[model samples]
Target: MEVLERLFNVALVVATLRTTAPILLVALGGSFTTKAGIFNIGLEGQMLVGAFFAVIGTIFTGSPWIGVLCGVAAALVLAFVFALLVVTFKANEVVVGLALNILAGGMTVSLLKAIFGTRGSIFGHGLVGLPVLRLPNARDLGWFGQMISGYTPLVYVAFILVPVLILFYNRSRLGLYIRVVGEKPEAAEALGISIARIRYVSSLLCGLLAGLAGAHLSLGYTTMFTENMSSGRGFMAVAILIFSNGDPLKILLGCLLFGFSDALSLRLQTFGISSYLVLAVPYLVALIALFALSYRARPRIIQETLASMGRALSVKPNAATDAEKAVTRG
Candidate 1:
C-alpha cells in the first residue's frame, strides 16, 4: 500500500506540471486573440511552424536558445500572414485559419523532404532540446519540494506572466482599446479605433506565445521533434481557456489538471498499462474538462442565443437586415 501510494503521488504531481506547461502557453495565446475579438483556429499550425524551425535552428546553430528564437520567429511570420488574410483582407476567418494549418503542414513536409531527402523525420549534428532547471533546495524539502521543482523556463514564464497580463489589460490604453474592439466594435470605431489593427496585433501576440509553447515541446520537454507532434494540444488549450472562466488562477488550475493527466499516463506507461490507454489520458482529460466547462457555460450561451433570437423575431425587416449587415462588418 505504501509503495502504491508513493507511485500515485509521483504520477499526480509530475503529470500535472508536465501537462500544464503546453496548455498554459496556448491559453496565453488564446487569451490575446479572444480578447481582440478574433478566434484563432490556427494555433496548431503556428505551433507546427515553430517546432519545425526550432529543430532546424538547433541543428544548424548547435544551441537550444537559438532554436527557440528561430521557432518563435517562424511562428510570428506565419501569424502576420494569418492576420493579413483574415483581418486586413476580410477573408473568412475560419477558412483562413484552416488554410493556414494546411499550409504549415504541407510546407513543413515539403521542406523536410527537400532538405533531408526524407519525409519521415530529421535530426541534426547536435541535440538541442531545452534543459530542465530544477528549483534550488528542491531535494531538501522532500516530496512537496520535489513536486514543484525541475520545471522548464517556459513553465515559470507562464506563472510569472499572469500579473503582467492583468496589468496590461487593466491599466493600459491599449488594453482599453482591445476591450473596446472585443466588447463593442462600433463604439471603438466611433472613437476612431482601427479594428483590423487591433486584431492583427492580437493575432501576432497569440502566435508568439503559441510558438514558445512549441519551442518548449521541441527543446524543453523533448530533445527531438516529430511530425504533428503538437497533435491536438492547441485545441486542448482552447478547452482549457473556456474551462478557466477567463480567470488566470483558474487557468493555472485547469492547466494543472491536464498536466496531471499527462503525467499519470507516463507513470502508467512505466508500470503495466497498455501504451494505447496511456496515450489517451491527455485527450480524455481535456474532453472531461470541456464537458465540465460546457455545463458552466450553457446558461450564458442559452441566454445569449435566446436574446438574439428574440431580437430577430421582433425586429422590422429593414432593421433586421441592417443588423445582419452590421454583423458582417464586424
Candidate 2:
C-alpha cells in the first residue's frame, strides 16, 4: 500500500510531464514526415546532434535561447541532407536514416573530444540551461500549482502544439496537401502538387521539432550533454508515431504513457528496487503496449488481407471469362 501511494502522487505526475516533453516534441515532428508518407528513422540522430550543438551554443553565447536556435539549425542541416538523399536522389529512407543515426553518434563523440576535450560528457560553469516558468499565484493552489507550474517553456510549447497540429492537419490547406501527397502521390502530382517539395518540407519540419526536443533535453531537463544523451527518445518518438497512427491527440496520449513509465522507473529506484529492473520499465511498457495494440488490430488486418486476395482472384476469373468470350466471338 505504501509503495502504491508513493508511486501515485503529484510529484510523479510532474516528473511524467517533464519526461514527456522531449518525446512529445520529437513525435510531433515525426508526424509531419509521416503525413507526407516519409518514413524517417533518423530522428534519433537529429536529436543527438541538436543536444550537442545546444550545449556548445549555450557555452559560447551565454544564452539558452541562442542554444536552442543553434540546435534547431544543426538539426535542419541534417534534415536537409536527409531530404537531398531520400527525396531528390530517390535513396531508400530507411537506409539513409540509419546511416544518419550512426553518423550523428560518431560525429558528436568526436566533436566532444576535439572541442571540449571531454571523452564521455561535457558540463562546466559556462553552460546555460533554460529558465522555468512559474505561473503567477499558482503556488497558492497547493498540489495544483505543483502540477501546473514550474516547467520549462518548451514543456508548455510541447503540450500546446498538440491542438495546434490537430488543427493544422484537419483544417489547413498545406496540411491537406501533405495528406493527399502521402495517400496518393500520383494524384497529387496530377493536381500540380509537387511531391518532392512537400516531402522536403516535411523532413525539415521533423528536423526542427527534433532540434527543439534535443535543446529541451540539454537545456531544460539537464544542463549537460552526455554522449548519446538522447537515450533512444528519438526511436521512442518513432514508436509513438506508429502507435498513434500520426494523430496529434493520440500522439500526446502515447507520449504521456511513455513518460509515466519512465517517471515510474525513476521513482521505483528510490524504493530499493533493482536498478536494472527499474531501468527496463519504460522499454518494457512500450513493448507490451505495442504488442497489445498489434494484437487488437490483428483481426482487422487479416480481414483486409483476405479481402484484397479475394479481389485479386475475382479479377483473374473475369479476365479468363472475357478472353474466352472474345475467342468464341472470333
Candidate 3:
C-alpha cells in the first residue's frame, strides 16, 4: 500500500511531463511557422507521418534513437511539400494545410496496412519504448528525484529546446528577418531579406520539430503507430500558439497545461472510464484555454473596433459637407 501510494503520486508528475512533451515540441514548431506568417495546420499530419516512420524504422533498425532521426527526416520532406505548394505554387495555405493533414492521415493508414498487412493495428512480439532515465537510489533523494531526474530522453530534450528557441527567436538576425517577413513582406524584401527563403526554412524547421514530437510518441512513448496517431495534437498546438501569441516560453507553459490534463485523464482510466472521455481531456483543456484567451482579447478588440468606428463617423460629416458644397457650386 505504501508503494502504491508513492507510485500514484509520482505517476502524476511523470505523466504531466509526458503529456507536455509533444505539445511543447509542436507548439515551438507552430511558433516558427506563425513567425513566418504561415499558419501550419499540417502539424498533426506531419507528426502522424513522423510517428509512422519511427515505428517502421524501429522495426527495421531495432533502435529507437535511429528511428527518431528517420522520423524527423520524413517529416522534413512533408514540410518541404507544404512549403512548395504554398510558397512556390501560390496555393491557398489553408486549403493546402487541411489537405496535407488529410493526406498524411490517409497515407499513414495505407502504408501501415500495406507494410504490416494490418488494416487497423500493428504490434510486435515485444517492443521497447523510449529509454527512461532514472536516478540511482532515487528514493533516497525523496521528492527531489521525482522532481528533477526521472524522465524520458525526449522529455529532457523537449525542455532543453525551450531556452534554445527563446535564444534563436530573440537574439538572432535571421529571427529578425523572420519577424519582418511575417509582419511586412514588402519591407523585408526591400531590406533584401528573401521572404520565400525565410518561409521555406521556417516551414522545414517546424516540420522537423513536429516530426520530433511524433517520434517521441512512437519511439519513446509507445510501441506502435495507429491511424491519425497525432489525434488533434497539431490542432491543439495551433490553439496554444494563438494563446501564447508568439511567446515561446509561454507556449511551453501552455503545453504543460495540456499535458497535465492528459495525465489526469490517464490516471482516471486506471479506474473505470470511457476511453473516449479519457481522450477528450487534453482537447477539452485546449478548448477552455482558447475561450479564455478570446475573452481576454475581447476588450482590446472592442477598443480597436470603437476607434475604427469613431474614425469612420468623424470622417463622414466633412465628406458630406464637401459633397453638398460641390453640388451648390455645380
Candidate 4:
C-alpha cells in the first residue's frame, strides 16, 4: 500500500505536468508541419539550438524573457533554412531534416566553445529561470492544488494551446487552407493557393513552437545549457505528433501519457532500482506504448490475412471439392 501510494504521490503528478510541458509545446509545433503534409524531423535539432541560444541570451540580458525570444529567433532562422531547402528547392525533406539535426548539434557545440569557452555545459551566475505560478492557498485544495499549482507559466500556455489549436484547425480559414493544401496539393494549386508558401509558413510555425520548448528546457526547467540538452524529448514530441495524427486533443493525451511515464521512471529510482534501468524506463514504456498503438491500428488486410492464416493452421484442408466428390461418386 505504501509503495503504491508513493508511486502515485501528488509530487509524481506535479512531475508529470512538468515533464509534459516541453513535449506538449514541441508536439503542438510539429502538428503544423504534419497537417501541412510535410515531415519536420529536425525538431530535435531546432530544440537544441534554441536551448543553447536561450542560455546565451539569458546570460547576456539577465532576463529569461529575452532568452525565450532568442530561442524562438534561433529556431526561426533554422526553420527558414529548412523552408528554403525543402519547400522552395524541393529537396528531399527527410534528408534535409536529418542534415539539419546534425548541423544544429555541431553548430551549437561550436558556438558554445566560442561563446562560453566550454564544451559540454555552461551555467551563468545569477541566471534566472522562468517564474512559477502558484495558486493562492493551494494546500487547502488537496489533489487539485497539487496537480495544478506551482507550475511555470509555460505549463498553462501549453495546456491552453490545445483548445486553441483545435479551434484553429477546425474553424479558422487559414487552417482550412492548410488542410486543403495538405490533403490535395493539386486542387489547392488549382485554387491558386501557393503550396510552397503554405509549407513554408507551416515549417516556420513548427520552428517557433520548438523554440518555446527549448526555452522552457533551458530557462524554465534549468538555468544552464548542456550539449544535446533537448535530449530526445523533441523526438518524443514527434512520436506524439504521429500518434495523434494532427489532432490537438489527442496530442494532449499523448503528451500526458509520455509525461506520466517519465514521472514514473523518476519515482521508481527512489525504490532503489538501478539508476540506468530507471533512466531507460520512460523510453522503454514509450517503445511498448508505440508498439501497442501500432498493433491496435493494424491494417484491415493484415488482420484479415493473419486471421486467415490462423484458420488455415487450425483446421484441416477441405476433404474434397464438391466437383471432385461428385465425379468420384459418378
Which candidate's TM-score is highest? 2
- In the range 181-241, model 1's lDDT, one tens digit per residue, is 9889999999999998898888888889889988888877776777788878777777766
Q: How high is the CA lDDT of each candidate model?
A: 0.81, 0.94, 0.85, 0.88
TM-score of 3: 0.92
Best by lDDT: 2
In model 3, which regions exceed 4 Å deviation? 1-8, 125-127
Each prediction's TM-score against the native?
A: 0.85, 0.93, 0.92, 0.89
Candidate 4, 219: how far from true, in Å? 0.8
Q: What is candidate 2's lDDT per residue for 32-133, written digit by digit as tens?
A: 999999888999999999999999999999999999999999999999999999999999999999999999999999999999787998898599899999
Supply the TM-score for candidate 4.
Answer: 0.89
Please write out the lDDT profile of model 4 over residues 230-289, one tens digit for every residue.
879878887887778878999999999989988888889889999999889778877987
Cα distance off (Å), candidate 1, residue 192: 2.6
Better candidate by lDDT, 1 or 2: 2
**How many Å off is the CA of 171 in candidate 3?**
1.8
